[model samples]
Structure formats: structure tokens, C-alpha cells
Target: MQCSSYWFCPDVWTAVILLILCRFRGCVSHLKINKYYTIKSEMAKDFPTRAENYAQWYNDLVIKADMAENSAVRGCMVIKPYGYAIWEKMQAALDKMFKDTGHVNAYFPIFIPKSFFSKEASHVEGFAKECAVVTHYRLKNDPDGKGVVVDENAKLEEELIVRPTSETIIWDTYRNWIQSYRDLPLLINQWANVVRWEMRTRLFLRTAEFLWQEGHTAHATAEEAIAETEQMLNVYADFAENFMAVPVLKGVKSPNERFAGAVETYCIEALMQDGKALQAGTSHFLGQNFAKAFDVQFLSKENKLEYVWATSWGVSTRLMGALIMAHSDDHGLVLPPKLAPTQVVIIPIYKTNEQLAAITEKVDIIVKNLKAKGITVKYDDRDTYKPGWKFNEYEFKGVPVRLAIGPRDLENGTVEVSRRDTLEKSSFQIADIETKIEHLLQSIQDNLFQKAVDFRENMTTKADTWEEFVDLLDNKGGFILAHWDGTPETEQEIKEKTKATIRLIPLDARPEEGRCILTGKPSSRRVVFARAY
Candidate 1:
């Protein structure tokens, strides 16, 4: 049966219904092409077209945009090639920076012995339940011969734990790899997969398995290790601001929020366009914790042996989720130029042989010049789709820039430049195309960061009392700066009452005299709190 609005307007119902279904389901399906009009007409009623429901908005953006999809295995994801391409661009940018900073990449074992984890008591306790244990090996034949069963006799005495992180085993190897003070700072980074068995997974945000780069370094002294920790945190902050174009608030996590076994944890927190907080990246200063656990010692220049200080920092595929929620809008993903796989794409709209020939000629020259300047470019000349289809496709893909050339422009000697970030279009002559593209790409990157910064500024609230804190979280839904009693009890109480946790204690936080909002105990300084991803 047709709906009232659609039945009253049958001719446009196809588009309306397709849009409605896509918005409600949060993704357009291949089977819905005939229902586009009707879906679109009712899309607004389903999605609300706002970031007020941030969790749903994020999930919708990731799945609806075709960036990624959930896999058959619970909490796991199949990173489609399109999503992987984005990761590749991110890897290329970050990997180059690591190399430039004198870091070398290495691979680590995916499975660590269960005993290795027991070496660090605190770390083991923190990750025990979340770790995936490999307890069995080969299975025996079933009695009915329908399936194989676990071989009771083949059970092993020891088990292996799929690494949630590589700190323990990496330190164990570092103990042997570093025997002298000369091998002081072993700056090693590993790009590989890690497993964390999360209860609930949301595409890229939380998954059973994900790819990431974990940097583990062992230093001769605590000072050097601390420096490495802070340095990498800064590196993460810089990358978030410049490459991903996501503005982050740099701070040190409170003890309650700190990574287990680490003396100090530094993190960069980013505000989503939806007013939620995502802990983008973290750097931990493990002051003798892992060194003592692994007995990693090095001979000092003074001819004595001393335990090394270690630091571990990592940023995961979750960065992709951060990018989407930080800059993307209802239209689709809006990638920063540096992180976009294709910074600029040329779409030629031509119907006649002369027009096709002219567009092909101009687009080829533009692609060549852009390539010479080290910009990634794509020319879409597929015959199956119209120019309007290609526009929506690239916009959905979030290419940083788009240049459109049609038959009309061929006679005028001009091309249309459409920027992805602002959706702004301007006409330009062929001669200045290269220079103009360079400026537009850089401008898009800058515009994205500034826009996020502005959103963060407007969303952050200062709460002086308990009621105000609850009210701010209930309504405003961003970071709350409030004084704490500096006790776990107070933190837990706030979390129990409100779903907010202490996101971070600013690295630049100052010592002040105040009272805890919950406990009324004398306190100094404040911690930022928000419901997190």
C-alpha cells in the first residue's frame, strides 16, 4: 500500500521512499534503486538529520557511506577496499613521519605466552577478562564422523594470549636485544594487528580485531623514557591537527583513566562533530614497570647495570572513526586533503564526440600536472553514469576537491572547481588550475581543523556544582571541566550517577585550591569529564 504523501504524489514516490529507507536503515542498498524518490522524501523523518544522537550518527556515517561494514564474526569488521584505501593514506602519512623522526618499523608476534602477561601484575589484571586466550590446538574426529572435536589428550599445559597490546613480549625481547648502554634507546614501531575482545563493536570504533602501529622504546634512563613518552604524545597531537585535520585537546589521563601499569598516561582527546569525546591516541610512560617485569637491564656507562625505562604509545584504526565523526556531515565523509586517498578528481560531462574529445584532452593535462606536483587525482569517464551521479559518488567518497568540465565550459575556456569541505564551487581558467588546486587542498585541511576547534570551544562547559554537571552532560553533552576530590571514590560516584568519566587531566593543569564537587573534600585543579567512545 502506498503512503498518503507518496500516493498523493506517485510520480516522485520512488525517490522519496528510497531516501526514507536509506535514512532509517542508515545505508542505501543496491536493491533500492527503483525506490529512490520515495525514500529521499521521507529520509528526514528517520535520521533526524542531526548529530544530537552522536552514537547513532557515527554508526550511520560509517555504514551508510560505504566506508566499512560489520563482519560475520561478532565484533569483527571487514574493512572494505574503500575503507582500506583511507587507512593506506593514513599509514603513508604517519609512517613517513615516524621514519623522519628516526624510528624503525618491526613486526611482533601476534600471540604472546600466557606466562608473559603474568609478569606484570597490574597490566595482567587490567586486561585479563578482555584478552582472548588460545587454549586448544588440533581436534580429534567425532564419533559420528560429522565433525571434529577437541582432542582431550592433546590439551597443552600452557596457553597463549592473543595480544591486546605487545608491551610484555616486546620488553622480554628488548631485554636480550639490549645488553649494553650503547643500545640505550631502542625506538621500534610495529605495524600489525591486535585483538581486544570487546563486548560490543561498532564498525571501526570498536572491533574484535584491528590494525595499528604500536611504538615501544626502552631507554637507559627515566628522563629519556619520559621524554619519549611526551614526544610521541606531541607527535599524535600534531598528526591529529595537521594530517587528519581533527583538533585534539592534549592532556594527561588521570590515574583512574591511565593505562594499567603505566606511571603516567598522556592522551589527545578530540571532540566529535556530534559533541562526544573520542580518546584519539595515547602515550604511556611505564616507569620501570615492564623493565622490572621482564628484567630488562643494560650496563651503564659507569660500568654498572641498571633497569631500563620504557614507553609505549599507539594509535589504532579507531583513528578512522575519529576522522569521520570529527569532520564528516550529513552529506557524507569529508576527508582532509592530506589523508584523502584522492585529493582531487576530475569528472568530465560530455555528450558529443567533440565535447568528449575536448574534455578528455583537458582532464588528461590536469591529471598530469597534478601528478607532477605529487597530488593524487582521478578522472571519471565511465559511460554508465551521468554527471550528476558522479558528483554524488565523489561527494560521498569525500574526495577533497572535484573539478567538473562540461560541454558548455569547453567553449568558454574554464573549469568548475568544487571543494569537498565547504561544498563551494568556483570557476577558474585552465592555466591557473594547478596553483588553485594546491591552495584549495590546503585550505580544506585548515578549514576542517578550525571548524572542529570552533565546535569544541562552543561545546565545552564548565560545571561548578553537581546539578550543573549533570545538567550540562544531560543537555550540552561535551567535555565538563570540574573539580574532583582526587579520590577514586569520587570518580566512581560521578560515573555511577552520570555516565561520564574523567577523560583527562590537562597536561597544562595548574595547582589550585578548591573542593570536590561530589565529596566536598579539599581539591586542587579540575579534570575534564564526558561520556566517551
Candidate 2:
């Protein structure tokens, strides 16, 4: 039998492994000494500027800011504590909104029986390429090799697929729960991780596994289901604008882009700093498709049996990517006040331990007052790092506000306040520091949103002719409002030529007579188009 023992490795190979790890240890020690500051400094030296390359800037910021890192598994990421903390803030805000909309949280299984997938033909077709299937029940040591292998004798009669989405399993369970109209309008949501087996992945943007909340609601009629869909879309738009401080366009997806198994899909799209569009969130009007597929029937008030109408809406951690690309600058992340894990970081400046102790005392009082006013504050009094270094670190991490207190400031009864959004610094009196910080945070949030909106408006342009559209796409690279022939053929042809997809047709688009940019066919209204992440 071949040995599975690690000690059986050839001496040369073992020596090579040890040499590599020894080199890695030195690098890791350097990184640990300065923490993220070392990463930021290295990024400053080696990474491309945001203007030079937005994609590289993004990857660099995600890593240097300690948001996330690529995992050992291909197409996967490990969200660092800081990143997960921001995600928790998002979850908390969205959870409140979902609960306010009469939706209750529920848990769903991660694995779906293979049979459930085939029930929805369109869904299976849409997700088939990305599905991760589990074919065997057990693994055993290989008789002829060193490592374990699948146990053929333990293979199951049916395979299980890791959930790409929970619709099939949820609807199958709904059939048993909804026997009467009283059970109609069953609003449930689940916060879960899903696997999509992505071919290529980026941290929060397109990972193989990501965290998200999926809301599935049952309705008595198509009208009710449609209303639920729109309501959830509004919720997402509201959250995006108010909490994330990112303005979004509320729109309907083109037929070619509608969600799988959905009759109509509604979404809120946000323009990124790079002029690309990112889908912040989506709500789908399923319109009885899932119900019909799973035979989820309900008895009506008139004693009639009918299939239930359905809707599903979701927002994922991809919003983290959206937030980053929408508002971040060349320095690093520019997190909104509401979503920042630590909204304010206070650093103490001093030459001696005595000076540090005195500054800490004042910082404690300020922190207490700030916390009382619902501000998340972190006091960095660690003697290992100087105050200037701490300031740069927090700025890179996108803390909305930073307060610095020195011995001179203690005598003056003031603190130097820095706003991350504008990179502006000012001195504020300690008498009402909490109130000042509160207003400053709101100002920073508003400033970031307004800045993004202005950038989007300046970048957006209307193109009446094909030449103009192509020029804008090649040069300006923002949203192009152009007419379409309302045909999939035209859409596909434009995408093939320009690599720009119809991000959406604005819900509020006015009717107009024009020609399609690509085919010059008669068109009714314009749609938003952009190259996306």
C-alpha cells in the first residue's frame, strides 16, 4: 500500500518547501510589524493609481485596507474581520428594512436534491454551468494511492447540488405550507451563503461563495406579487441612497437580462467611479413560475384551488464592491458613515508615556460622549505606532472621522478633527465635540453621495446617433442613454461589437420616437448602457 504519511516526501522537495516558508516568514513578520500600514505603503510604491487602472486600484485597496483576501481555494475569498464587520452593518440595516416590510427571517438548507433543480427548466439552464454537484456520500483511503478518493460503493442514488439560489427548495417547501388563502402572502427571507462555482472571481464582486439575503414572498394574486416585487426594489433603492450613500437608478431589466424563472425583474443600478455600472440589488416578480413548477397551490376564499403567485428579491455582499467602486478614491476606501465599521478613530500624540496617559484620559471622556450619541469610536493609544502612522492607517481604512489629541490640544481644550471624505482637517472645541462629530459625519455622508451623483451626471451623456454612442463608449466611458429597437438581436449585436450591455431601461423613461443605435430600427424609448464589472 502507498503511504499517506507526510514524512514520505522526497528530501529535496521537503527542503524546497522549508526554504519557501522561511522566505515567507520574513515577509509575514514585516507585514505584522507595521500591520496594514506596511501593506498600504507597499501598495503606494507598487500598485497602479486609481486613474491609471481602476481594476488594479480596487484589488489593491481591498487587500491593503484589510477588507478581504483571495483564499487558497480558487475563486473564493476570505473576508477579514474588518470587511465582515462592514458586512454586518449592511446586514443589520437591511434586516431592519425587511422586517419593517413584514418579512420574517427563516433558515434554508444549503443542499438541494437534484430532482428539485430539474423542476424549473429555466433556472436549471441558467445555473447549470455554475452548479457544484455532490455525487458521493463518503470518501475513503485509496487502495493504490496516498490520498483519499471517493468511495464508489457509498455513492448515492441521487446527487445533491449546492444551492446557487434557494428558490427551488423554498418553493417545494412552500407547497406544503400554503393550503389556504390565509397562508397566502407568506413573506420569508434567509441570510445565507451560496456557491456559484464561478470561473473567475474577485473579492466581494464575483466570488464562488458569497453572503446574501434572499427574500421570497407568496401572494394570493399576480397584482400582490408584483407589488411585493416593486416594494422590495424601493427598499433596496432607499438603502442604497440613504445608508450606503450611493445614488442608484431604479429600472427594469431588459428581457435578455431578466432573472431566471422571473416574469419581470426590477433593479437598482449604480454607476461606479470608473464609469462602469454595478447592479447594487435586484427584485424579481416571479409571477407564479416557481409555484407552478413546485405545485404550490392555495385554496381561495371562494373555495377554489389556485397556484400561488411568487416574488423573490436579493442583495448580496457585492454591494461591498459597489460601495468601494462608487465612492473610494486613490488613497483607499471611502466608506459611508452608516456602514463604516468604526466611524471615528481617535489617535493620541505624545513623546512620552506620561503624555500618552494624559491624552488617553481625555480620549476616554470623548469616546464615552460619542458612544452615548451612537457613534462607533476606536481610540488608538497603542505606544508601538506613532500618531501620524495611525492617522494614515485610519484614512486608508476609510474611517469617516478621525480625531487627534496632543498635549497642546489638551491645554487648548480642542481636538483636531479630520473628515475622510474631503480630506479636510479642522480644530474643534471639546465642549461639544460629540455634537460636532455627529454633524460632521452627516456632512461627510452627504458630501460623498453628492460627489458621486455629480460625477455620474457629468459622465452620463445622451447619444442620438450610433457614431456618438461609440465615441462616448470609447472615450467618456459612462452611462449612454440611447434608443434601442427593442429586439434581442439588436441588443446582442451591440454587445458583441461594443462590449456594452443595456444596464437597464429606466422605469421613468418617457416615450419617444427614435432609431436604434445599432440597427437604426424604429425605437420607442432609450435604455441605459454601460460596460460593467
What local lDDT does model 2 show for residue 530? 85
List model 2 lDDT by residue over 207-326, tens digit each.
889999999999999999999999999999999999999999999999888898999999999987777788999999998899999999999999999999999999999999999987
TM-score of 1: 0.90
lDDT of 1 at 388: 86
Q: Candidate 1: lDDT of 75?
A: 77
lDDT of each: 0.81, 0.85
Model 1 Cα lDDT, one tens digit per residue, 208-282 = 799999999989899999999999999999999999988888898878888988999999999765556899999
lDDT score for residue 424 of model 2: 86
Worst 10 residues of 2 by lDDT: 23-32
- State the lDDT at 444 in candidate 1: 91
Clashes of each: 18, 0
List ranges where model 1 is wrong by over 4 Å. Answer: 1-48, 51-53
- On the 0 to 100 scale, the lDDT of residue 509 in model 2 is 97
* Model 1 per-residue lDDT at 17: 8
